[model samples]
Target: MAASAEKLLNLLLRHGSLSRADLAKAMHLSRPAVSGLVDGLIRQGVLRETGCGASNGGKPPIMLEPVAERFGTIGVDIGHETLLRGVLCDASGKQLAVMELPHGNTFESISEQALKLAASLKAAASIPVAGFGVAVAGQVDHAANEIVYCANFPLKNRGLAERLAAGSGLTVRLDNRARAAAQWEYYFGAADNAEDFIFISAERGIGTAIYLDGKLFSGRAGVAGEIRSLLLPSPDGIGLLPVEQAMSEKFLLELSGNCPDTAGLVTAWRRGEPGAVRTVDYLIGGTVYVTGLLTNLLDPALIVLGGRFRDLGPEFARELATRLKVDPPRQLEFRLSKSGRIGAALGAALGVILENCKSNEP
Candidate 1:
């Protein structure tokens, strides 16, 4: 897989299908060069001719697309909650299988469950499994394939990737759930054209991932977006509190009269229940403050609200837009995540495909 060929694959993944002329134009390569690369990819079963494109007064050019049955990758999202989610994706980012299982009660138990989920997805994949990617909620040493620390789980310094690789006999990559989601969104979802944005993962706790220029910004400690400790005015008009406590899933649930889950809270909000209204108003205020703070600091172009935030519905974004007061040089827009709850899992799978593509490049 030469770098040019890799770019060809990426271009196809981005555009769905393209002709040799389109590839050549996008890659800035001659048609002969693009044809040679496409020929190689077709022979390798990585790509295939789909159909003929409409002609501009000449013979219709053949369109090419990734062969969904040629390559596969497994991704597992180990969230802070009790459920572990897994997704099997083909080279083109098309999901083959999706699964969920209960997480273990302890660190070792959770690791084992995650491995189990991976194996199950691998069995379900019709194509060759490239590797496994794990998106966890915490600080991860990506190069080391280890979790440095996680507030909800006792997995600090744990060689999670090593254990998974050993158990499944596959390569493994680890990353923060927020960063994983951000990367996937940038390449495939709402932020496809965005070069600078803030991805806010409002899961069990608020986790943020910052993308600057065109790359994720992991600070010196590889936890630059860890804003849980940032102080904000309490919803009760009392003294300040950690952002994590002020705007956490737990707090939201509590505010919604201890609703069983976010879905129920959304239901209550839709019904215009008093408790849910208070909960939403508090969440809006906190979000406005946080977005303004981040805008003043980094001045990103977009803000993506992911995880449980997606359950907040489209109205949430509308309300947020009205309340947010940021005066950056450029206007900042807020959008809900398009990937929903399975975003981290899908992103983790995309990571495996990307890493395997790089490592196996010829």
Candidate 2:
């Protein structure tokens, strides 16, 4: 990529749009160089003339912005508590359409389910879909694109993405959900401004994915974030199971009414009912204890909270931060992700994008 073009793309992604002179100043590139790159992007349909913008002096320039509707990508995240959230985006990652699929454990149905997900997405797509991405909750062998172990969807360990690709006639890419979600943070969210960060999530299960020196820290077995299996001791004599059992999708639902779904718990939490706050307190407390241990060991620059449970934002961060102070957590920055649920989907798509970029792009 041309150096000036790359800088202009980054600026456009971060700030949404800019007139030619504004982009030139932001990138510190000459006006002619900026204009050349912007013209190329416009001709490729990667950027478009959105309209005029006011100027402090002289006539207003035609405002330019990313043309995100020109292309699209599909992102899938599936685990014990399954979901198929596919985003249609352009080169700049502006979401055009989204289709969501949520289900429970049903692992024995992986092949058929994956095909269904792809087909449904292809059917609903309004534009040419360029790629497909899948993120699973488990340790991954990215070279083989296979899940090594999954607590939620055990059968997902097979060549599931390949099987789906054969069924749909579209090449597929797969990655660990934690790492994929963390990838979103590194490329597009809070971690975008940091060199290294740790991401923890709570969905049907608790998952962790770390980024170090601007890359996914998939040390050894690509199992860096399997903290659900950390096995902390319980306060009572009951010997600890994984903290996921104590503070996860199952626990949240159990903490609220014994609904068959996590939606009930979120609904109650959003309502700010006393029971919901108490439940959040208990779970966040456990999360803080475990995360404090991680901070001492991993020592990431920032700690990001993602996944479904993070919807409980301030309550989640406050409890985690407050308790950490008592034990003196060695100064970890606890923050909610800027991308939220959308980041998970973007992470999945990025797995595919990264693969192609490394091999096919010049």
Candidate 3:
């Protein structure tokens, strides 16, 4: 595959259906060149013609879309604690099947469980599974195909990607779960039209992924999104604490009388419970602080809130706008992600497809 072909494929993956003329204009190439790329991809079984588009006064041009029943990828999101999520996605980033499991006690058991999950997802796929992606919370060595270190996860510096590839006989990828979630938001969720934005995931801790000019920004050493150590005013207005402690799920649960989860905390807040109300207010403050910090530094066009906090619904976004203040001539948008629990898994699979395009793989 040529570079132009990869770009065309990615464009279609993002925008869905487009005609050859639209592709030519977007790619800044001649119609012949775009046609050639389209034809080649169609022959390769990744792209397909999807009927015709409306035209002004001439014959309608043929529209193209990704083949949703052919090439596919499997993804596994290893959560910080007991939860693990897996999904089988087509080339167009649509989830065809999903599976969930509890994390195993040890590294070997977890690895085996992940492999089995991947195998099960592959078996459930109607299309050919081209690759497997594993998304974790902490550092990842993509070049080495290993998990460098995840504070809350059991595995450390394990050749998880290689082990999965060898076990499943497919290409493998490893990445940060926050970044993977960001990818899902950018392509299929609220940030579809955004070129610069911040995706904040409030899970066990605070994690973020930055997109500048439509590209994911991984800072030097691939730790750009790790803000867990950033110190801020504590929720109780008692001195300062790191984000991991100040805005963590554990803190929220504890503050809400150890509610089973965020959903229950919301229920308590709805009932006008003082503890739950305080907890929600504290989280809102923390989110506003973090959003302000990032917005001032980067001046992004949008901010997306994900993870357990998404259950807070539109009221969270509305409250964030009320508390967060920005200067004149610069407007910021906030949106809550609707990707659900399978979002990271879907994004991990989409990562495999995007990487495949970049690598010129079939």
Q: What is the lDDT of candidate 1?
A: 0.84
Clashes of 2: 0
Q: Give per-residue CA lDDT, model 2, range 1-362, as digits (tens).
A: 45556556656665677899999887777888777877877776667888899877989898887666554667777743566566655555655566666655565465566667667877777777777888877767778877777777764456776777788787787787778888777767877677677898877677888777766778787787677767755534378767878776666666665445555665676688776666666666677777777777777778888876567666667767767742343566778887677666777876664443333211
Order the candidate numbers by TM-score, best to worst: 3, 1, 2
For candidate 1, the per-residue lDDT at 131 reads: 85
Show where candidate 1 strays beyond 4 Å. Answer: 56-59, 219-221, 328-330, 360-362
List, residue by residue over 4-110, the lDDT tens digit for candidate 3: 87888888888989999999999899998888888877888778888989987899989999888778899898765776789998888888889987775478877
**Candidate 2, after superposition: displacement of residue 342 in Å?**
4.5
In model 2, which regions exceed 4 Å deviation?
A: 1-70, 80-82, 102-104, 235-237, 255-278, 326-331, 359-362
Span of 10 residues, lowest total lDDT, candidate 2: 353-362
Higher-TM-score candidate among 1 and 3? 3
Rate residue 202 of model 2 by lDDT.
74
